[model samples]
Target: MTKKAYSKLLATATTTAIVASAFAPAASADSKDFSDVSTRYADAVSFLADKGAEGFPDGTFGTHLSIKRVDAAVLIAKVLELDTENAPASGFKDVPARAVGAVNALKEAEIAYGKNSSTFDPDSHVTRGEIALWIERAFQLEGSVEVPFEDVNNRYKDAISMMVANDITQGLTETEFGVSALAKRGDFAIFLHKAYQAMVEQSDFLLTVMHTNDTHGNIQDIAKRATAIEHVRSENPEALLLDAGDVFSGTLYFNEFLGQADLEFMNYLGYDAMTFGNHEFDLGASADGHKALADFIKGAEFPFVSANVDFTKDSTFDGLQNFEVSEDPADGEIYNGIVKEVDGEKVGIFGLTTEETPFISSTGEVQFQDYIERATEMVDKFENQGINKIIALTHLGYDDSLQYDNDLELAKQVDGIDVIVGGHSHTTLDEPVLNEDGEEPTVLVQTGEYGKALGTLDVTFDENGVLTGYAGELIKVSDLEADPVVADMLKPYTEQIEAIKTQSIGKEAAVVLDGVRENVRTKETNLGNLITDGMLAKAKTINPDTVIALQNGGGIRESIDKGDITMGEILTVMPFGNSLGIMELTGAEIIEALEHSVSAAPTASGAFLQVSGLNFTYDSSKPAGERVQTVKVQDGSDLVDIDENASYFVATNTFTAKGGDNYDVFKKAYEDGRLSEPGYVDFEMFAEYLKGLEKIEPTVENRIVDLNAAE
Candidate 1:
C-alpha cells in the first residue's frame, strides 16, 4: 500500500466526517442511546453526531466495521478543516458522489492520492500504519522520537516517530503498532479525534512583518521602501509594516525638515507603529524643547508604542500619551502596548527605548524606565488580556550598550516575548536570531542603518502562540523599482535636500579626509583629527581653559572628499547635530574614560574616542578597563603626564559629556554640575573652523598609540 496515498485518504475522511458531524443533530437521541457504540467509541460518535455525522448506513454506528478508504478520506478532510464543497473530480469511477469532494480536496492538498492513476480503491479499509503517515503529513508534524513497535519498518519510521513525539498514539499495544491490522470504525474514531484535537490545538499560523530601523531621516529611498512594502504585501497582504526607530536624524533632509519629511513618507507607506530611538530626542535641549518631537508624534499616522519611555514629564506630549495598554488603539497616539487583531488572532505589540537615552541624547525631562521591568509588565498585561502572541518593538541595540540593556539580554531574561524588532546598534540580521534559552523562544531581527535595506520576517506560530519557525532577510532597497506615488511624494523633499547639498560651506579640503568605518572606528584618521581639532578650537572660544577634545568614532559618519565641502557633506559626517560641551573632570575620571574608550580595541567599538589636545598609549594585550598605559594633557606648550588627583577641563560633544556610549564617568560629571553645553552644533562648528582655516590638511600624529601591533 502507498502510505502517502493512505495518509491523505485518512486526512480527507477525517475532515469530511468532522464537517458532517458538526452539522449532524444530537444523535437521534443522545449518543448514549446508541447501545451498539462502545463506551470508547460512544464519545467519539457523540462528538461526530453532535457535530452532525450520520451513523453507518444501519441507524447505529458500525463501530466494529472496518472503515473504508472512502470513509477515511471524508473523516480526515474534516480533521484537516479542508474545503471540500468545491473539490474537483477524484478521477476514480468507484468513488461515491458523496466521497468525491473529500477525495479531490485531499488530492488537491497533496495529502492523498488514488491507488493508481485511474483507481482510488475507495472501498478498501485503511490500515493503522497508513493512518500514521496520513496524520503526520496532513498536520505537517515534525520531530524525531523512538518508536518501539516491531511491526513498523523503515518506510513508516519517520511518520511513527512524529506520531510518538506528539503523543498522537501509543501504538496498538506497548510493543506493537498493529501496522497491518485493518482500522475499525471504533478505534479509528479515537485516533481521528486525537488528530482533530491536534489540528485544532497546534494549527500553524503565519505572520509576516516588514520592518526597518535606523533610517535616520534617509528618505532618499522612501520610494523604494514603498515598493518593497507593496511587494511583500502582495505576497502577504496582512503583513505589518513596523519601524524600530532612529527615524529622526541624519542627512540634509532631517536638517531642513526635522522629522517632518520622514513622517510624510512613513504616513504614506502606512506604518503600523513605531518606537522611540535615542536620536528622536536629539532636540530635547533646544530652545523650543521637545516641540519638534511632539509635533512628529502628533503628525504620525500610526500610533507609537514605548513602554519604558515616559513622556509624562513633558507637557508637550500631554494629549498624546496613553500610559496604559490599549485594546483599540487609535492612530496618532502613544500606548504602552496595543492589541492588534489579525485574522481573528490577537497580536500584542509593545515598545522599548534604551534607558541610555537620557545620557546619549538631550532627552530633557522625558524619563526612561528600566527595560526589563517595563517589558515584564507589558508581557503580564498582554497575558492578562489573553493575548499570547507578543512582539517587543525596541530601539535597544542588538548587542550594544550591554552595561544598560540590549535585545540579546532581553530575550534571554524575558519569558513571553515571541519576536523582537530591534535597532540602535544598526545590526543587519540577514537571518533572524533565535534565542530559545528563555522559557519561550524569541526571534530578534534588525535592518542596518540609513534606509539602505528593508527587513522582512516570516514567522510561524502554533495555536498556543509559541514561535516555532521563522525566515528573515534584508531586501536591498536599491534593487526595487520606486513606487510612483511615493516617488512623487518624495520629490519636493529631495529637491530641497539636493539644493542644500550643492551649497558649499565656504571651505576646501587639501587632502581626502579619512573617516571610513574601518579606519576611524579602530584608529585615528585625518577626519577624526580634524573633527576633534574643530571641537577643541570651537570650545576654546567659549572656554579658554578647555585642554582636551574627544569625539566618538561612531559619530563621524562619512569622509569629506578633497574639494570645497558642501553643507550636505558636513551634515552627512556629523548628522546628529550634537552640540559642544565643556566638562570639568578629575584626571582619574579622564584616565578611566580613556580606558573605556580603547577597551574594544583590535575590534572596532563605537565608543572608541578620536582626540585632540591629548595623547594616550594603551596596551591592547591588557584586559579592558586596564588597557591605558599613559595619558598626557597639553599644558600651554609642553605635554605633561595626567595627574590622577588633578582636575582638568575637556571639550567634546554633549552626547559624550552626558555619558553616551557607556561613558559613566562623563555622566557622573555632567550630573555633578561639571559640564556646560555651548549650543554650537558640531557640523556648524566644523564648517566655521574649516572656513576660518580656508583649507584643511589634517593628519594623525600618534595621538593614540596602541602598544600591541602585529608589525
Candidate 2:
C-alpha cells in the first residue's frame, strides 16, 4: 500500500507499566535555540525546553562547552524529579554553595553519593563514562550488555554496560566509548531529554483513541494488537477503538473464508466504529455477488458509518442499516456523525469512503456521493447537535495526488473536524501529524497496510471539550506475544488455512522474487513478469488470438523469499480472487488505456501494469496523456508497430476489464460487449505456471522503458 517503515525504539520506558503497554510516543522534532549546537541535537534541546530546563547563564545554549559536575547535578536533579525545597544536609564537605540545592537534593533522594564518601567534585569536568554511571543510578536501571570499550575506567564499566543495554548510548566507535572525553553541553541535553521522556510515557491521560487500517487479512499481528487494545481499555475506561477499513484481501484467511476470519477478530477487539474501504467491494457488485460484503456487514459488532453510501439503490447491501446513537442526532446525523457518550464526553464520529470505489472496486448498483460535499454536510450537522469534538473515519487516502479529494484536503476544507483516522492510501504516521493550518487544528493518524502496527493517541481536553494536548505513536505488532485467548481461538482456523498454504508448488531461483508492495506498485519486477506471463498463457487457451496480457501491480502483495515455493507463497503474492478476461480493442484504444495506467507514475500508483507480448517506452516527465512514447506488439521473434485502427485481442483480469484502476477505455469496451470474462482464476493459473517451470528466472528487460531514467 504505502510507506510503513518503522524506526528506532522510543525512550526505554523506565516506569513500571503493564507488560502490554509498550506504545512509546515518538520523539517530536521540535527545534530550540542552541546557536552552538548542531541540528542533530535539536530534538534533545527541544525536549529539555519542554521540561522547563535552562541553558547557559549567557542566554545561549552553549552546546559546544564541556559539562561540569555541578551542571550534571542540576540536570539529573530535575530529570529524576528530586525535591529541591529545603535541601538536606549533604555528607560531602567539598560541595559549593551555588550547587548545594542540586547536590543535597540528589543525596537526600538516595541517588547520588560523591566522588568519594566525603567529597563532592562539584567543579570537576564530567566524563562520558561518569555521566552514564550517574544516569543509571538516578533511574535505578538494571540489565547489562557487553561493552568493548578499552578506555572505560573499571569503576564505571558496569554502569556503562547497563546504559548501553537500555539504549541510552552506543559507543563513539564500535570499540570505543570515549570514556575520558569531556561530555559536551549537547550530550547532556540528549541524555536528560531521553530520561525525562521515559519517565513520563505513561504517567496519566484523559482520553485515548486506538485505530487500525488496511489490515488486509494479516490476522497474526492482530492477535497481539488485541492485547494492546485491551491494556488501553483497562488504563482509560474512556478509550475508543476504531478501524478505517480495507480488512478484506491479501491472504488465504480471506480467500478460503471470505471475511469471517478478520471479522471474528474485529469483534473480539471490540471496535467502536469503522468505515468501508474500496477493496471491501472487491467481490460484491452483482445481484447476488455481494455475499462476502453482506456477510461482513452482518458480522460487524460495531457501527458502520458511511454518510455517502446510497445502498437503497441496490439489493447487494440488503440487511445493512444506519445506526442511531442519539434521540436527536441532528438533522441528518447518520450523514453527519455517530454519537458515543465516552466517559460523559459526547463524541461525534463520522465515516467517509472514497468515491473512486466504483472505478477501483465493485459497487454493483450502489452509488457514492461527493466526499467533500458530504463531509461538509456531516460536520455542520454534528456541530448543530452540540458536538464539539469530531472524528472523521475515512477510506480517502492521506494526500493521494491522483484523487480529486484526500484526507489532508478534507481536513483543510471541512471545519470542526478534530481528528482524522484514515485508510485507502495505507500511509503510516509513526506520530500523529498535527495540521494546525486548518480552521480547527486537525490531527491525522494511519497505521499503513497489513496488521503490522497498532496506533494509540492520547488526547487531553478541558471541561468544554476543546482539545488541549495530545501524544501519539504506532506500536509495532510484530515480536510481541499474542493474547492466550485470541491465540487459542485462531489455532483451528489457522490449521485449516495452513493445510493448503504450505503445499509445495515448485522451486524459485536462489534469489528473492521481489514483489514488495511499494516496488510493484511503482515499477517492474521479476515476479510481475512471471505473473503477467501466466495470465497471457491462460487466456490464450480460450482465445488464441490474445496478443497481449496485462496485470495490475496493486494486485501483487509481497516478495517471495528465495527457496522452495509453496502454494501459500503464491496466494500471498496474488491474494485477490480475480478471473481472466479476453477483450478486443482498437490499437488506439489500447494506447489510451495504457496512458491511464501510467498517469500516476513515479508514485506507487496501483494502476501501474505488468505485461507480456508487448514492449513499450514512456517518459513520465511528459504530460499524463502523452507519457506513452512507443508501443510494439510481439510477432514471432520480432516486434512491430501497432496499426492505429487494427483490432487486437487482449487478455487481462476481470477487474481491469471492468474499469478497475480508472481504466475507462476498458470499461467502455466492456460495456460494448466486446469483452468476455473467461472462467480461469488468476492465482490458480499462476501457481500452475510456476510449477510448470523447473526454476523460474524472469528478468526485467526494459519491456516497459522509462526514458527519463537517471544517468
- Highest lDDT: give the candidate number: 1
lDDT of 2: 0.74
Best-fitting candidate, scored by TM-score = 1
Tens-digit lDDT track for model 2 on 348-459? 8889888867754667777788888988888778778887788899998775533345788888888778889988666778998877767677888898767788889866
TM-score of each: 0.59, 0.54
RMSD of 1: 15.0
lDDT of 1 by residue, 464-530 (tens): 8877677668999999999898899889888887898889877788999998998888888989999
**Worst ten in a row by lDDT for model 2:** 1-10
lDDT of 1 at 605: 87
CA lDDT of each candidate?
0.81, 0.74
